[model samples]
Target: MSDRGRVPGQDYGVKMIPYEDLLKHEPLREFPEIDERTPATLLFTSGTTGPPKGGYHTHRGLVLHTLSTALAVKNPPVNASQDDVAMVLVPMYHVHAWGWPWSTMLNGHRKIVYPGRFDWGHILRVIHEEGVTFSAGVPTILYNLLMHPDSPKYDLSRLKFIVGGAALPEGLLKATQARGMTVISGYGLTETAPVLTIAYLRPEHRDLPAERRNEIYLRTGINIPLVQLRVVDEQDRDVPRDGKTIGEIVVRSPWLFREYIGDPEKTRNAWRNGWFHTGDAAVWYPDGYVKIADRLKDVIKSGGEWIPSLRLEDLISTHPGVNLVAVVGVPHEKWGERPVAIIVPKPGYEGRLTENDIKNHLMQFVEKGEIPKWWIPDKVIFVKELPLTSTGKIDKKVLRDQYKDALPK
Candidate 1:
């Protein structure tokens, strides 16, 4: 097998194995000897908080994750037949891609591996030629495809479904659905072997009103079987399930990773009481669905109150003039930290928005007391585009490093 690294356009420096060689290799006689506690794979955390940590998963854990995710998304004997072909768009190095490759193989599907880097033209061509029925990608990748000037040049009707994550934006989902494609949003982290919950349209919900169904589509989704989830407070106590009470999300699953590699102390802290703590703050709906609000570390703490950065960013992105936006915390003496929004305006719309316009739009929320007056961003930085990570999420660490020192004393 040839081992290569760092292709020109790829971000994560993934190692690619030729499809011909992969087909010729003999299957393993037995699964690797790994206990429930042994490390099967090491996935690095997103590191939006401080530094990336490597979370270790076991062979059994990964298998559980795969089966549960497949069941949640309704990939059954019909849609995902043994003869079905799958073209993976997410890089193999990412948890979404890494976990899916094994899951597809386990289900006996034919896999067409894309070489390093995502070429939109090449991807469309391969799907039609290979008769690819299922695909997995991040929302950013899908957005690029749906907006590509040549998208109509390729026949994509054969695609049955697309599993999107790694920062799924609402507008991206709507755009894909408009093209007669089914888009499923799933939530997970590298630490969990990455498939904890999936947004599936329940059989009963199919007959519901169009507007009601659309509301369900906006939620992150319900938990898959065998995974126990709860929204908790700082004291590790469960929060009310009124669908409005916000708390940190914690999970206990058969597929949970053991701990962060080489950091037992952190591992012990995160896995306290035998439950893996997800630092993401979230809320649960009355119907047992969970919606992630923001990362605890990323939440802006202003004037002894918490502001959900993810919610704010989502709201800002809905504006037609805004292309992309990231909300970051800027140091403050009185409030401890305040929010600053970095915006990339849509083409030809730059310099059209003023600070007053933003405040005016947010004034409606201020009146409802959903947000305080002080929570408004101190300043807005306009840019051509936001820097993204290998997985396509905003690279907040890079932004922090660039602006952390520039914060006012």
Candidate 2:
């Protein structure tokens, strides 16, 4: 019990204090008045490519994020109000829990919650028993809830969830909706106070049928207020709003992080051309919706053509027998690189799914001209589980390392 909090081989140079002892010092109920521009807190990125980078936010930034994000969700469609209760699932260590703990609480809401440790069965119970109307998490958490052994026992019909940290797989969204939860996708990174867009349907599309509406929902979505978001090419010119061309997503907003701590060279590179580079690749649509295709590093370049790995994953996920899927570019003799899939089958479909099954399914889209035939993966390899980043995204980086030379040399 002695010095349990101390980590070996390091001196933090601060005395450790107990929570109970600190409480006895008479807590200050009122926050000290401080300049709006004063730095408040710092957060780190997911570090998918390298060591995590830090982002610092000011008091002013936090307030703006709170006001804007609260208003966005409180409006029609979401309509979160005093009646709403949040069992927020995103971790506090993760960029203000995507800004909910402060936003929702400060927005005059009556209550808030944390499900604690993210056990789906327990989370479902908390939602059912506590009447949690709103929540936010990455797509993997939602999938776990839908596939939980006791999932059918709980009533999740009243819940409306905000999904981010990764693209929502089409099949997962459909499955969640079928069980009566209203699921919406969101987009952001550690750099932008964690939320830059929410897929709120525009008024015209709001009247569309479910099939059509879901297509809109699946897109990365329209930007929230005060966020200047753009899809730009290497020249920093806007791509056409034709919904097919791919470009990097760049943004300028009031609440963005100040910089990556202690890395001036990388920081300067990220802020080139007057906007903070997002490193996410996406397509712009006519109705102001933007569909994220893949991380720039994750996009597949094969035979001089770009293939969006996310789009391929979405299409493959719709197969009933597929539980999870990842597509990565593997070095190939003929094409420089070719797409190969690694799939995790549903509970009973193990050893039953084949490369041909996926190819034939993709062929339907090819026949319809929805996708080029050459875009089909060269092979589909089945596995029991797929690797994930700390942020819960399917870790394509890991997959590429394992299968980079999959094709015969």
Candidate 3:
């Protein structure tokens, strides 16, 4: 294996030890006694919005998270077992790959496959060769896998995917379904030891039709075991479970970081009223499920009304011509900010996907009362490709910066 991302190129003050040389020494005869609250590791945030912040996890927290995550995948629709193999695609440096390195051991998975780098074709080959049955990654990674040229040649029928880092789009979900792969949505953040929710079906709803089932799978999901999640307004009051009232998602979990390392003010602001604020806007439903709208900073303020970028992007992604899409708000004199869609067209669609075509596509949804007519993007710009963050999510911060002044007064 190539030691690209693994090797620290610079001389950092600490000495490095080779695995082979370290094993030559005898094992420790005794272990040191330490409190469970002792810090185990410190991981920095993905920093898609701004500068990365450090969050430390306690030994106790990681243990609980491992158990909780193991339980989550074993419950209901997932029912992960020892027969299953895991190819964890999430970066290990980010939230410890959603705590799977520990959880997989707890779950006693049949095997674990690690792809040193995210070469899509190589991943497909690994999946086929290793008989990989389960995987977890951001939507972008899943997108690349499905769009790969050799995707059809591989048998992904038995594969199950857990998608996080961003909301899963309907089009992508359906495409995966068509390929006989099971995909579920998940939601979390860096500070919470990251596994907040997984969209697994309840026992009662397991017999529902495919369309109904897919709707549930597309949601942000309900709280995982031991995770107390709530959607609250600015006053910190719980929002109604009407599935329309948007509120910030606040969470209380055993594994959450106590503070943002070295940033006291941010730490205080994040953990207010005894909950860690996720800064993600979402809606609560009577079914006890939460559906994310957009990040608080990414929500577009148009004519004093909130236009959720995620919902718009989800709808637009279903268009046949669009391979990848990002909806961002640009400054507008009359409306404060208007949505503009940046798209990457699929092969054979370049230069053919026009603004009018997108507006017309959205109109169908508007007519069905699925989305408000006024929510349509004012402009659509096709791009060769969309920018991605280190964690493989759409880099909305970069998009916003690049198009901050895209609109004319």
Candidate 4:
């Protein structure tokens, strides 16, 4: 190992550790009786809408999560096994990079690429050079990759992506699908050993029409193995599986983090009612799939019905002139609250994007029964850019604060 001088953001210098030195350490010849409940690792939650929290997990939980996840990929679009190559892009500091480090090892080395510090150009090069077949990251990572001008230089048709960190919008999903790439959504948190669900289609839907099956890929998905998930209301009762009843998502998983470190009050609240409250508001589907519409605090309560802010954002994202978009609930006298859209138009469309364009685009979905008329935003506001959190998700808290009064009394 050689020292690499001083390292940024650290008090000490960086050193490269060699594999020969690592293997020189004493090895355990025989296994000893060990309790799987021992504390394994600590991870910090992304905290997109609030302050980040520390979460801890156990040995048993990690193994189970790794095993279950490996088994899950054995079927369907991501038929991962010993032959598949993996290039995990999720930040290592974030939920064990969605637990790929250990999970990938269990399936043996199928070629792994670690492009340190996320160079977009380098990432594209690695994918092509290493013959990378699979990868996972937040939606932003994928967006940047596809949006990169040099993206066309690389043949990415062989790659499959597992999106998480935030909801995957229909516009983004379809864009990747058009490229003949395998794109799917997964849902989890730092508190749940990180992955509780992935949007893999069921046996019945596998033979369905292509368009119909593709729609399933846009959902937050059904719970993974051993995960007991529920979309429930204030009374802690499961909401009707009508695919429109919005409710909080809570889960019971063996691999869930132990608790929030140094925060008892928050921990208690998180574990209330015998489940780990995910704070995600989603609709329950009859097919056992869960489509997350919005976070509870981010849901727009206009009139007596609930408006999913993410849904509006997704619709706006499809506009040709749009670069990015965010929807928030604004105060109103009659309805108590109303939806307001803040959009970032493409460079040429700046200040040219009109409120009517968005409303008219959304009406097409409404006319098709994709959404209700009341779900439409009351107003549209153009913006230079949408605020983003440290993790690159749209910072809705900032948006709410800035536009809370967008709708007048």
Which 10-residue window of candidate 2 scores lowest in summed lDDT? 1-10
Q: Each candidate's TM vs. the true structure? A: 0.81, 0.91, 0.92, 0.87
Model 2 residue pairs with clashes: none
Query: Which structure is stronger by lDDT: 1 or 2?
Result: 2
Clashing pairs in 1: none
- The number of the candidate with the highest lDDT is 3
lDDT of 1 by residue, 1-409 (tens): 1223211122222333544567778987896444454445556766756687765566678778888766665532114656667766777668747476766777777665553457777777777777877777766677666656678877665565544454455555555566766666668878777777766676667788765765566666778878898888888898999877889888999877665666778888888776788888888887788878787878888878888787777666666666677888878887788788888876668889766666676677779986667777887788887788767778877876676655678
Encode model 3's per-residue lDDT on 1-409: one tens digit a residue: 1112332233333333554666779987996676787666667788887898876677888999889889999866678999999987888887899987888888999999898888999999999999999988898888899899999899899999999999999988988888899999998888888899999998877999999998899999989899999999999999999999999999998899887766789989999989999999999999889999999989999999999999999999899888899999899999999999999998899988789999999999999999998999988989999998888888988999999888887
lDDT of 4 by residue, 197-290 (tens): 9998778888988788777888898898999999999888999999988889999989986577667788898898889999999999998999
Local distance difference test scores for all models: 0.70, 0.83, 0.88, 0.82
| Model 2 accuracy (lDDT, Cα) | 0.83
Off by over 4 Å in 1: 1-38, 75-85, 96-98, 106-116, 128-133, 152-167, 351-375, 405-409
Report lDDT (Cα) of residue 229, candidate 3: 90
lDDT of 4: 0.82
TM-score of predicted structure 2:
0.91
Each prediction's RMSD to truth: 6.5, 4.6, 4.9, 6.4
Instruction: Sort the candidates on TM-score, descending order.
Output: 3, 2, 4, 1
